[model samples]
Every structure is written in structure tokens, then in C-alpha cells.
Target: MARRLCGEGLGTMLLLAAIVGSGIMAERLAGGNDALALLGNTLPTGAMLAVLILIFAPVSGAHFNPAVSLCLALRGDFPWRLLIPYTAVQIAGAIAGAWIAHLMFELPVLQLSVTARTGSGQWIAEAVATFGLVLTILGASARRPDAVPFLVGLYIAAAYWFTASTSFANPAVTVARMLSDTFAGIRPIDAPAFIAAQLLGALAGLAASRLLFSPDAKPVAG
Candidate 1:
């Protein structure tokens, strides 16, 4: 349990750092238009998450995202007792990472709001983006643990390109992003709706996983 907790904490911290650091760099490098900037941000996020999962999956099951943890619990992989702690640590890590990025960028650039949003179409985009993410994680990793890291990284990269929401699937990340005034932040007022949509999408992914991956399949030993 201690090992799992530590892995979760470290993974979450790395996740946030990659997000904020890459976002800051992207903004600076991309100038005004953010296309190249987003690529800069997401590519490192995908790579780092893959590395973290590879490094920590044996210890904490590598659930860097609270939503991923919740879904895995529903699938009967994770212990229910660890849920709150895991989520709390993940959120804290995200906040700390954002704070680090703020410090690195020297405050002025960090103070500039970089939160992103889309029109009503974006709500649907968020749903589909999250659904694809959860589904991919479950199919590629939870159900088939051998492929966890690589497949997850590939899925994230694909989701970033295909989804309009840029596939911000984790609620903790959504909340942490709000603290940063940088390109990675989410507006506080808009967060709840995006989070709700992500949860619903996760549920859909769970159902799909149940249908597609047999419950009788052998569980991957942690």
C-alpha cells in the first residue's frame, strides 16, 4: 500500500510538471498562435506518462489520473480504500508541479492566463475525448497489463490530435490547471462542466470495457 501511494504521488507530480513546463515552453516558442505550442505541450506529456507508468506500474499500478483510478476500481482492480488518498496526492502533486512551473517562468509569464475553451461543440468534444482515453487505457493496460505504458502513451498522443478538448481527461489535472495562469490552465467557472462530462465519459468507457473485455479473463497481478 505504501509503495502504491508513493508511486501515485510521484507519477502525479511528474504528470503535472510535464503539463505545465511543456505548456510554458510551448507558449514562449509558439509566439501568438498555439498550434506548435500545443504539440510541444502534449508530446512531452505523453512521453513522460509512458515513462512513469513503466517505472511505477508494479508499485502503484500507475494510476496518475484520479479518473483512471476510479475506473479501475469499478473494474475491480484497485482497492477502494486507496481511492481518496490516491486522488488527494494526485491533486497535490499537480498543484505543486504547477507552482514549480510558475516559479520557473518567473511569475510574469506565468501570470498570463492561458486557459482554453471551446464553444458548445466542445462539450461533446470533451465527452468523446475522455471516452476514448478511458477506453484505450482499459483496453490496452488494465485488461492487458503488459502493454500499459506504450499503449497508453500512444493513445494520449492520438487523443490529443483527434479530440477538440485536447483530451484533458483527469479531474485532478483540470483542477490543478486552474491554479496556473499559463497556457495549461482551465477557467475555474468552466471546470465543473468539463469534469462532469469527463466522469460521464469514463462511465461510458467502463461499460464499453465490460462489454469488450471479458470479466473472466485472467487478472494481471500487480
Candidate 2:
């Protein structure tokens, strides 16, 4: 149990560190070109996600996101008892990671984001992005467990460009980013809606996964 919690904390910490650190670095080097900076942020995050999952999945199932943990619990893949502890550590790890990125970049460590990421469209985008992410996880793990790391990594990388909100699919990531006043930051006022959307998406994804991928479901004939 201790090792599992540690793995979750450490993995989430590294994930946020990579996200915020890359955003800072990308923004500084891109000379105000949003697209270029976004690309810079996208690749490293995706790569680090794959690496982290591969390393930590064996230890704690590598669920760095509260939404993922919750969904897995609902699916009976994770214990209901450990959910709270996992979530607590994940959030703490995310905050620590953000602060670490700030220290590395020499920025204010306790700043709240001023970037406005609001509106119905943005919320819808977040919902869709998270839905796809959760779906990918559930669906892929059903048959191709070995492919989960690569699949998630590639999906996120693509979603970064395609989604308006850049796919802040993880609640921990969203909360942590709200404290950062960087390229990847989202306003604190906007965080609640995003989180709500992500949760809804996660539930929907779980439902879809059950309906489509359940063992009782009939296999399609070629």
C-alpha cells in the first residue's frame, strides 16, 4: 500500500513537472508563436506520460488522475478503499510538481493563472477530450494491455493540437495548472467547470466501455 501510494505520488509529480516545465520552456523559446510553443509543450508531455506509465504501472496501476482512479474503481479494477488516499497524494504531487517547475524557471511559486479559458465551446471541448482519453484507456486495456502506454501517449499528443482546451483530461493536472501563470495555465475561475466536464466525460467513457467492451458483448464477425 505504501509503495502504491508512493508510485502514484511520484508519477503524478513527474507528470506535472514535465507539463509545467515544458510549457515554460516552450513559451520562452517560441518567441510568442503560440503554435510552436504548443508543439514544444505537447511532445515532451506525451513522451513523459508514456515513460511514467511504463515505469509506475507495475507499482500502482499508474493512475495519476483522479478521474481515472474513480472510473477504475467503478469498473472494479481498483479498490474503493484506496481511492481517497490515491486522490490525495495525486493532488499533492501535482501541486508540488507545479512549484518545482516554478522554482526551476525562476517564477513565482504561488501564482494563480490569469489566462481565461472559459465559454461553452471550451467546456465542450474539454468534455470531448476527456471522453476520448478515458475511452482510449478503457478500450485499449481491455484487449491490448501492452499497448496502453503507447496508445495513451499518442492520443494525448494528437489531442493537444485538436482540442481547444489542450485536453487537460486529468483533474489533478487541471488543479495544478490553475496555480501556474504560465503558457499551460488556466484561470482558477475556469478550473471548476473543466473538472466537472472531465468527470462527466470519465463516467460516460466508462459506460461506453462497458457497453462496447464488456465480456458479455458479442464479438463482431469479420
The models' CA-based lDDT, in order, is 0.81, 0.94
TM-score of each model, paired residue for residue:
0.90, 0.98
Candidate with the greatest TM-score versus the true structure: 2
- Global lDDT for candidate 1? 0.81
Look at candidate 2 and tell me the lDDT of residue 60. Answer: 96
Residues 20-109 of candidate 1: C-alpha lDDT, one tens digit per residue: 888989999998877899899889989988898889887888888888889888888888888999999888877777877777778743
Write candidate 2's Cα lDDT for 1-222 as tens digits: 999999999999999999999999999999999999999999999999999999999999999999999999999999999999999999999999999999999998999999999998888888888888889999999879999999999999999989888999999999999999999899999999999999998899899999888988777889
Q: State model 2's lDDT.
A: 0.94
Clash pairs of candidate 2?
Answer: none
Reference-based TM-score, model 2? 0.98
* Count of backbone collisions within predicted model 1: 0
